[model samples]
Target: MAYPQHTTTGMTTHPDLTEMRERLERTASSSGAIAVEGLILLTGVYTAISPWAVQFSSQTNITVSNLIAGVTTALIGLGLALAPERMFRLAWAIVPLGFWLVVSPWVVTPTHGARPGIVWSNCLAGGVTALLGLIAMGLTVRVARQSPR
Candidate 1:
């Protein structure tokens, strides 16, 4: 029996892989996608600082909660902006994270004693985060459908 000779020293590159990479690059570079990614990053940064900005940092529990959630959201947003091909699949995670932010004020605070500013801040930020998550999901789905199998 004779072994087949390799054409090149390096590993073979699949055509589909190249096409997929190109498609992902196109999707990431699209104007609308860039805008959405930027908005997501801004929202995350706002959320992270909102506890102090809204003057609700006294509530230790809610303060810590917002800090963690906000940081996670910001990191996710950054990841999506920097590597959409790898990060877009995680877009759906933002929806639940946003929902948690919306309800955390009441649940994390004692006796439902969240200040109006805290409530407004969390609700607004959460709503925006959820909406951005939905938009990101749509963009991911659209790109997936457009790419050839």
Candidate 2:
């Protein structure tokens, strides 16, 4: 019996398995874009649903506001995840979204003003969203700087 050679040759040689594995490892790493995108996505979802989660849906205006912001944030997160190369710059926009979420209780509250639960919920969600946006922006900037001009 003859043993087949471990190597084969072709016009396109076998891809570098080590390099491919390394790339897969990098892509699946916790710090990778997918992970961050997931965080952003969750943040948006929480923000949108906070009115119900925190039981402040009685305030129609605030509920609507949160729904809008949450949906928008989720969409942005999705865009970033799906087309990061094109949408990375939009990360900066998230900073403002975060700010809006933070202040939405005040701005979107009924003339009665904001409830404590609403205030706290918006603040927390907004802060997290803003922080995540900042992280996304920082990552984008770092990647840009590292890329060859």
Candidate 3:
């Protein structure tokens, strides 16, 4: 798993040649996290627009909640993706956000009727978010364990 590197002296180097190729290994491992972060961001955007897209914008309470949650989730995903070294630990927080999304239909007041579509949409998105959050947490733990301690 040798990766190309350029030295200050205009020379090529293969740091992966070292006995402990931690940096290269870490970069390789982070691909999954990057993908998950993108999915999380997409979910957030979907959640935010779901109320209108589903024709349930009348439910102002749920709409507002979803908007707030969606924006926050997107921001967190962006933060983790852009600054994993400093923000990976924040990944765990997204789990609770997912849980909130899952239960939001019941928690937030809706306008006159119970919309099954809204419930299902949130549940589906939330379930995916929470599942990915768990996976991210596991990967973070694994990476930490693999680091020289």
Candidate 4:
């Protein structure tokens, strides 16, 4: 598949060909590590804010399973940040997160005291986090495929 037409962009974008060439040269000179670092940073921020500010953590609503998921996210976030170059390939984790973020309102189904705002906000947060993960994942994968290791 002749991709890269739209799906990927490095650290540079230009309106003209000459500027585009220069931007590409600059990005190619120092892109791989920076891209991975950006991805890890995104994961870190997402992990930090999600459980406290984004979750519906009422005593009645919060439970053991959610705690487990939060713990799991912490571990995964650590992995992504520490060894982003290696672990970044395991990017499919974003899919479920994306799914949940997109459908959290329906999934939560708040009956009595519906926190639709919280649900939507958290869902959107998760979706944005997943997007960041995907960007890093795809970029690292592309670079790996293009460059010999």
Candidate 5:
């Protein structure tokens, strides 16, 4: 018996991969998904500038923390918007990031003690970020289950 030899030129295509991409595209293009992505972007922007807006810029530690978190969140939002198929895999990350934002006021600035403004700002921003993350995760699940093989 002779066995067939398989050869590859690094240009192989899989039907399942194509189908999954299509499903992800459809999910990402939905009006609701678009709105969520936009909102997430806005949330990131708000979180970044919140320190100054809330008059908490005096705290160097928290200010830097928020700036970093805000930039990261914004990047995630952009990734999702630009490449949902790939970025959705990271949807779960936003939850933790949000949680960190919420607790950073206490954790990052424990020595100085968090003012009401800082606490309120972080809590609200964190809540919104976490909520949006949940929504993004749901969308990811929906896309995955759309057409199971």
Candidate 6:
């Protein structure tokens, strides 16, 4: 019986697998663009939402925190658009990601604490954003590694 060949990711089957590997590499590169792009976008939305913290939060530092978040998100957005490759490689890229996780629980907290939407809205938005960002970061890393010089 003859063995069937594998065809996927725009590549045909090959004995040496060079063709297949190259196709996969290209496919990954394209995928990386989206992953990186998404992370950047999520980071932006997170930042933009920060300014509106006063609406959901009654905390004194909500304004300050929101400002910082805005700046961070803007920076990420710029970075992603400018040179996603560098942004992806940044050593501290994952630092801000911690915020979404930390903030999520707060959203669920009741108004007795200090904010209206702070406890839940942000939690949901941030959570989704964070997940997308993480996925993008991962894909960026994979694509970066696969890319040829």
Best by TM-score: 5
- Which clashing pairs does model 1 show? none
At residue 67, what lDDT does model 2 achieve? 93
Best-first order by TM-score? 5, 1, 3, 2, 6, 4
Across 1-149, the per-residue lDDT of candidate 6 in tens digits comes to 99999958553454546643554345435755556555656655664565464364445454455445545655765666565544655424544544553474344333545354554554554565455556656655565456343
lDDT of 2 by residue, 1-149 (tens): 99987865663555654454444334434366788888999999998899899998888898998999899899999887776666777888888889998888778765789988889889999999999899888777665444222
Q: Cα deviation in Å at residue 121, candidate 4?
A: 2.1
lDDT of each: 0.87, 0.80, 0.78, 0.52, 0.89, 0.53
Between candidates 2 and 4, the one scoring higher on lDDT is 2
Model 1 Cα lDDT, one tens digit per residue, 1-149:
99998787353476577777678778877998889888888888899898899888888898898888888888988998898888988989988889998999888986868888999999999999999999999988887788495
TM-score of each: 0.85, 0.75, 0.77, 0.54, 0.89, 0.55
At residue 13, give the lDDT of candidate 5.
71
lDDT of 3 by residue, 1-104 (tens): 99999758432365433423454346424778789878878888887898898888887888998899888888878877777766677779889889999998
Q: What ranking emerges by lDDT with the best candidate at the front?
A: 5, 1, 2, 3, 6, 4
Off by over 4 Å in 3: 1-29, 110-113, 147-149
Question: Whole-model lDDT for model 6 versus the true structure?
Answer: 0.53
* Model 2 weakest lDDT span, ten residues long: 21-30
Off by over 4 Å in 6: 1-32, 35-39, 53-58, 91-95, 98-101, 104-112, 144-149
- Tens digit of per-residue lDDT, candidate 5, span 17-134: 7778888888898989888888888889999999899998989999999999998889999998888777888988888889999999999988869999999999999999999999
CA RMSD of all predictions: 4.1, 10.5, 10.0, 12.0, 3.3, 11.3
Report the Cα lDDT for candidate 4: 0.52
